[model samples]
Target chain A: MKGILRSLLTVIKNTFIRSITVLYPYDRIIIPYNSRGSIRLVVDLDTKEIICDGCGECVNACPLKLISVEKVSHDKKIKNFYVDISRCLFCGLCEEACKKDALKMNFNYELAERDFSALRHDIDKLTEYAKPKVKEFWKS
Target chain B: MENRKIKDYEEIEGYDIYIEPQFRPFGFPVGLYIALKDGVIINIKPEFGYLTTGVEKVVEGMEIDKAIPFIDRVDSSSAISPELTYCIGLEKTFKIDVPLRAKFIRTALCELSRISSHLLWLTRLANVLGINNALHYCLREREEVLHLIELATGSRLTPNFIRVGGVASNLSPRFIEEFRKFFRSFRKNFNMLKTFFLENELVVNRLNNLGVLIEEDAKNLAITGPNLRALGIKKDVRIDDTYGIYDEISFKIPVGEKGDSLDRCIVRMGEIEQSTSIISQAFYKMPEGEIRTYTEDINQFSGNTRSHIECPHGELAMEISIDEGKITKLRIKSPSYNNLLAFSRAVLGESVEDVEVILTSFDICVCEVDK
Candidate 1:
């Protein structure tokens, strides 16, 4: 009987405490600074061009081979880069393998899509997602 | 009606009952086949292989460094154990010396994983016992631990933080401070949870002396972890086979007096306390050094090695045979396989209603069993 009363006390105490949940659409929780979400390509702040040199480092580092890089013959620039985000492990290995800091994992975790092909990101989508503001936010 | 001869039901064999398998909310599905007689279980057989992903076979021929992510998914509840076992095995085979700071960080993360895993088990047990409040409380505490892991390793369930030579990144001061704060609150809340569960008359009566697994059967079956310790056997891979910075830190292994369902619960609860102390010790004694040793020429490594660690479930071991930098053979000896076998044996002679209680008490991860 004493145990039952103690349990009841605990239940009562918990009832008065503030809730820890956030109303998803109305409110949001602060994600950790180091949280790994989706992969993005870093762009040059001044030139607005991708900093990747088509070096194939991330391609080699990827275990699942989700990344594909094509280089232009004229100036060793990235002609095309594709990432299959549908099957991406998001393990952050590609970001770690980039030598020029051209690859990063941003906080844009909302990657759900209705169509399968929509999930496969191209160079334009990747570069557009790497906003200069996001880089500055992480610096702090 | 009088011309027909009636057969005696007692002369026939025991009835066979098959429990339809269903997907557990946590993942994996388990079914049971029971032989019943007079409301008692004559024999019980557990069915596995519902969630097999061929983890071991998939890792074969992959590079050593790239296989960490796949191995991390072997046991989704505690991802670090198998990754650590595999990394330790590789490190041993290639004769790589992990830095002291890396060792301390690994120990801290591993203990944190243990605590979170035990909390998850507690939530499931509470759910099974119809204690809705305890279930919610356990989940609330478990979320904090998962957040701490995410803060440190950038992912919640599968950190993929530990590497072959060392850890992925250095621990920030903010993470350490936050962990200390969490530790303080967790200690107090844990006591409350203990009293709420253990001291309750309903829980004690329901769990005490139910599905008793004798020490001899546990030993003969080669059971490890809390289930084995519940039988009053003081055997832990972390102590018997010391690894990482465990030799530097001091802690006690909690043992139980009886090998019943209640004893298992007590032993796991005691483990959560021990794990917290270990995390504090590892953090306090942590030294300043590099987090990872530079292993530029990993492709030249070639050898076969086996490494085992005390997982939250039981003894999780990984064996690797590398030839010219490619994995030729990889095998994982998961603890759940043996625990499932023991569960099968323990449920015999118990009433049919106690099967779920005994199954949850064993804390079997079908993912590991199917892997």
Candidate 2:
């Protein structure tokens, strides 16, 4: 019985602490480094060209089959890449299967779409989601 | 009692009370039908399968890697347990040894998931019992655990982090630091929970000796995990079967004198402390190594293997057969499936008012049972 009274007092005391609620839109959490928010294409640093050779590996590797890569050149270079974000599971299988590491799961999580067609994006919109990788180091 | 004609009592079965399949607490659709005689529940039947996703049939002939996402989706609350079981089955079939780092990570995640799942159970119970402030406190603490999970695996509920031979990635040092902080503070919160809820006279009177399951009955019905342990039966998958570095760790399993509703609740409270210790030990002994071994051939083995784990609810088992890079057959036996049977048997002869208290005490996951 005394323990219960002590607990009640503790609860009442703790209620005076400032609320930890973050006001959304005014305050937001810093997204982590390896968060699988959205899928994007990785561009090569040396050459001003896309790294994917349009081999359709991501298309085949995708469990949901939400990806399709089209070729416009005779050399099988990727011209247009379509991704149905609605059907994507964000499992990172496609990124793992990519031979050239051209595909990556990015950290941009604000993916609300007003229309269904807006969820289906081509190469340009997908590439725009990619941001520079944040350097992560383990605390010593 | 039999000769008395009660109000609204049908001629066929004394008083046939039916509850339609509705969305119940804990976000699962379930229904209950009971026959009461003189305010005592005489007959009870639980209805389920309202949210079947046909997950088992959908994963047929799926590639080994692709089927994991579906496996992880089997139970959102206990996602890591099913995924870990699936990966263990596949790894056993392929004759691959999981690294020490991966094993430690899996153990830590499994323990954290247990803590969070129990918190969810308590949250729903607190809300049902009108302990609104306790509900918020439980959710607040549970949110801390979920945040730690999100920081580690990038997603809160469905991590999909466990790979076949290892984890999907390495854990950052920040996760360890945060986990230590949470671990230190969780004990005080849990003690308060015990004092406020478990030791309360009203709660004890409501829960004590309401739904009793005998030791023989528990074993005969194949009840497992904490539910079985609540009957004073020393049967745990982690201890009896031994998996995921649990054999290396030293932790005591809590058992109750009589398997009543209150006993079950107390046993779970005991388990939360045990899981915290397990996680701390696993984190301390964690070694530095590769997170995953990129196996080119994951489906080289064709034989079927069954993997079982001591999930938060109870024992969860999975059987997977791989043939040439694809899963030919898959079967899952979740703890809730067995606990539901035990629930039906235990709830008999209890007062009608104690139905919800008895039901929540079992910690039955409708998604796992229905799936």
Candidate 3:
């Protein structure tokens, strides 16, 4: 009988507490600065150039073999780089293996799309999602 | 043993009751075949493993670096175990000593994962028992743990943070401070949760003595983790194997008297407290140093090594045979594979309606077994 009353009282106390449910698409919560969401190319801070030299380190580093890099020039400069985000585990190995630090896992997580074609991101699409390093945000 | 009795289905009359593979419990696909005699279960022929990824086949012939991510994918709920186990195996095979700071960080992350997994199990058990408030509270707590994980590892669910020699990144001062705040309030919050569930009459009445697993049976059936611990066994892989810096830390292994469903749930609850304390201790004693030591060339490595990690579920052991730095053969023994066998025996003589509740209490994840 005491246990029942205690449980009832606990429930009554909890009823007035704030709800933890996040109303997605209406109100947004800040993801942590280090949160890994989507893989993207990095930009050199000084040069303002997309840092990828068409080197295929990421292509080799990818666990699922989802990344493909094509060389189109005599200097072995990259012509096309494709990442099938649909098949990506988002493990961030490609970002870590980039010798030039030219790849990063960005914080923009809203990647859901209706069409499967939209999920396969090319180099241009991947570069557009790139932003400054998370260290800059950490300072603020 | 005096009270144990296997009911005969031939004598009892009732509606032909059988929940097929389609209408399974826990909203997951599992073949939990049970025969009910007058609303009571007469026999259970458990058929698990619907979703098999064949990770062993995938890892063979793959480079050691690439295989860590796939190894982490084996059990999503406890993602760190297989990754850590595989890395530890590589380190042992190649003769590499990990840094002290890295060992502390690995232990902290593992304890955090255990807490998060237990919270998830608590929510599932509460939902199965029709306790809405407990579900909300457990989910709320779990979200906080996930945020802490995200702060340290960049990803919340599948971090793949631990590498061969050390963790991927060092612990930031901000994360350490936020973790202190979390640690301060955790005990209080967990106590309230315990009071609501462990002491609640409804939960006790429904869960107590439902599926009793004797200690002898648990050992003979190859049961591990909280399921085996609930049967009054003081055997924990952390203490027995003394892996990592676990030999340096001080924590109690909570053991149960009767191996019932309620005991299983309580044992997990006790473990959450122990894991929290262990994390706090690991943080306090953490030294300032490099997180990782650069290993020598990978291509020249050769050896066959086996590693065991105390996962949230149980001991996850992995054997890797490396030839010229390439994985030639791999074998994984997940705890869920053995726990499912014990689950098949535990669910016998239980009613049809209470099947989901009993199963969740043991915290047997079907995907882990299938992996």
Q: Residue B64 CA error for candidate 2 (Å)? A: 1.0
| Ordering by DockQ | 1, 3, 2
> What's the lDDT for residue B330 in model 3?
93
Judged by TM-score, which candidate is best? 1
Worst 10 residues of 3 chain B by lDDT: B3-12
Model 2: CA > 4 A from native: A1-4, A43-50, A129-140, B1-15
TM-score of 3: 0.91
Across A41-138, the per-residue lDDT of candidate 2 in tens digits comes to 88876775788888888888888899988897778587899999988787778887888888888887789988999999888887764445465764
Which tens-of-lDDT digit does each residue in B278-325 have in candidate 2? 999998898888777878755565777888888898888888877777
Docking class of 2: acceptable
Quote the positional error of residue A29 for candidate 3 in Å: 1.7
What global local distance difference test value does model 3 have?
0.82
TM per candidate: 0.94, 0.91, 0.91
Q: Against the unseen true structure, what C-alpha lDDT does each candidate score?
A: 0.88, 0.83, 0.82
* Residue range B228-307, candidate 3, lDDT tens digits: 89988788889988889999999999999899988888899999999999999999999999999876688778889998
Question: Could you tell me which 10 consecutive residues in candidate 1 chain B have the lowest summed lDDT?
Answer: B3-12
Every model's DockQ, to 2 decimals? Answer: 0.69, 0.38, 0.60
